[model samples]
Target: MRAIKFNILLILIILNFSAIAQIKVTSNTFYFGTIINIEKFAGKDYRYSLELKSTETDSLKKIVIQTRQVINKDKMLDANATKDSVKDTLWHQINVSNKINLKAKEMWLYATFEGNGNFFADNLKFEVKTEDGNWKEVPIKNADFEKHDKNPLKGFLTSAKIPDGTTISLQPRTDAVKGKALLIKSTKAAIIWKTNYGSNRRTGKYCNVNGIKIYYEIYGTGEPLLLLHGNGQSIVDFTKQIPTLAKHYQVIAVDSRAQGKSIDNKSNKLSYDIFAADMKVLLDSLHLKKVNILGWSDGGNTALIMAIKYPEYVGKLIVMGANLNPTENAVEKSMLNQLKKDFKMLQLKEDAESMQMARLLLMLSTEPNIKVEDLHKVNSKTLVLAGEKDVIKAEHTKLIASNIPQSELIIFKRETHMIPNENASLFNQTVLDFLNEADVKHP
Candidate 1:
């Protein structure tokens, strides 16, 4: 009986040790270490400082302290760290200071980590500059990371996983700079998160297309692949795809006419034809003759129109959740109804921004009148994709593929309209495979 008890105790100890292991994070994925709402700091000049120590410093590994401050509900300012800021076995202090725009309706502070390595963070400080050039502290709870528990992380709106190879232990550590520090260590594992997609200024540019300025960001070097986001979204929609896609192709992600950083002419009406025309003009300005296109939702509709109106500019095509027409036959009735409700609400406001929003909803409710027979005009190979549970009807997605001569169709089972954001790995790989396939011509 005593021997049996010892074996059971040994098993219990093993299980306990397993539970104490570090949280595993996937490699090449962006993670939000902490998020703090700072709306109260609006219009104030502030300084954010933190101390981090890296046991194994890596060039590819990154940790970013970013702030989201918006003006006119559009303009944004973000602060990022240099790749070399992190050092080995030494506590490094990082600091960022800027005036929080008064016009911003919402503001947030974020700490993000990515790549492979282990690090400890402590002594986070948020301070606002006074009129007399003095820095005053702003109260932030648990900034020292001393609280220890299963959910040891407190005071953060969202908590990120401890990196793959590191463990968050309640036991006091000998190497801690002060008290205990938060450990984020990762070997090579997959943990999904986001990147600074829509606001990357390094590769972003503006082009005059048909009188309106369009914003676009380009990355990598290979066959050009244009990415078009759905309605009410910006280049940020593909935050999950850009890093991976950029590795294999020259990704040209555009902020369609009126959304994201690109502003539209409030006087002009929105339509798929006009959007297609803008795309053609933008490509012409860039001197790109033929390019692969990937469009989601309204973007898909514009791409289809572009293929039909200017077939010469298209090399290959991929459309997800696209519809030939804005009718119940193509889109779900519930979605159309919601759009109608939103349009009605926006009409009541009757302001310039409201009018623009109403116009977008109007397009969603009644636009993209593509004829099914027109698919024959598209000469480039096409790939049609949708989720089984997408707001777009399954039959409509299939109809698009059947009409196009050289087209393929795929339906991700149990997925939704947001597959690009939710199932990025599979969605990106599928898109890459289609783009990478060599086209064979047969006489």
Candidate 2:
């Protein structure tokens, strides 16, 4: 019995030691836009200064640093995340070496401490090397990352003054080393939250045109570039394109009449002609005689109408997923059928949004009868775009492109009807390329 007791005590001691061997790492709530001072660095080119302090320096554990674009996570920053050995609690200030290639609003810097140990990092910051050989701080809030569990990320990184029609949520992650990072999700933040730099100088206003109130957002400064969204969609569809396009041009993203937050004004029917006329008046209201236009789906239909009717007003025309007609050959029957079902489903519900969706779908079903002869009337240079898996038939897109005297056709691979939203960077680049190309007058 004494021998048995000794064996049990030895086992208990071993279990206690194993439990104590586990790693215990805790950190503060992540700081957003923490701007680090640049003067501390030797050269003009500045980088992140991570001041990490460990409780007990372990030979096996190390901290790895990385920076990546939040929008395009695939592209790694030039200043790659390097793992630094933790020989002591305070050895040397980690210099994330290299000038940030992109602008301040482009990237997010992150650090991960690996292995079994407790690590502490404070005075974490990121600085940008300016064009005039000056270093600028990219302001970060809750900088030290000391507010975890007590105040989780879900309700954190927010304020009492959140923009209307938007909500921020958090997605839990287990693989996040040291519980270091959290994925902040702003479900419908496009209307208000534009960019990370808080540089959304996008101004919004309402204009009374064509017997309805049209809502529009004007971004950046340059030659006016009008952006139009798709069917059952609003200016929010161009959320991805606006930031990039605004960089080069004065982007004017508009919500079509009766769509989004715009007032319908009890119009008898919805048609592309009405939409075109309304947009024409918006231009007149803004006193814009000529402007470049980018359109997708139903908006494409309206742009073509404007180009054909008011040729003098259009500078450059870009149309994606627009159909001349919704026949079986032009638009697949299944697509039309699905639209009809959706419209009916909405209608049967007898809701405020029901009639709006139904009318829009009705417009899709019966409108946009742009004959090849009509296409010839548009004198503006055009870019005809379609997706590989678009609801609009390839032949129809080809027909539209072939009809236009000076038009470039581009069918994006692995893309569908929602090219503007799905493949925004590519679409924006293509449009920008076409817009910036040497102007060639179409006969």
Among these predictions, the greatest lDDT belongs to: 1
lDDT of candidate 2 over 157-274, digit per residue (tens): 2222333332222223233234342322222222121131111223667898856788887888999999888886776567678889999999988988888767684737789998
Flag regions of model 2 displaced more than 4 Å.
1-202, 265-267, 438-443
Q: Give the best candidate by TM-score.
A: 1
Query: How many angstroms is residue 286 displaced in model 2 relative to the true structure, after the best TM-score fit?
Result: 0.4
Residue 158, candidate 2: Cα error in Å is 23
Q: In candidate 1, what are the lDDT values of residues 233-274, reduced to their tens digit?
A: 778678688889999889999998888788985667798788
Clashing pairs in 2: 28-145, 28-146, 28-147, 29-147, 33-139, 33-140, 34-139, 34-140, 35-138, 65-81
Please give the CA lDDT of all the candidate structures.
0.73, 0.65
Candidate 2 minimal-lDDT segment of 10 residues: 190-199
TM-score, prediction 2: 0.56
* Model 2 lDDT, full chain set: 0.65
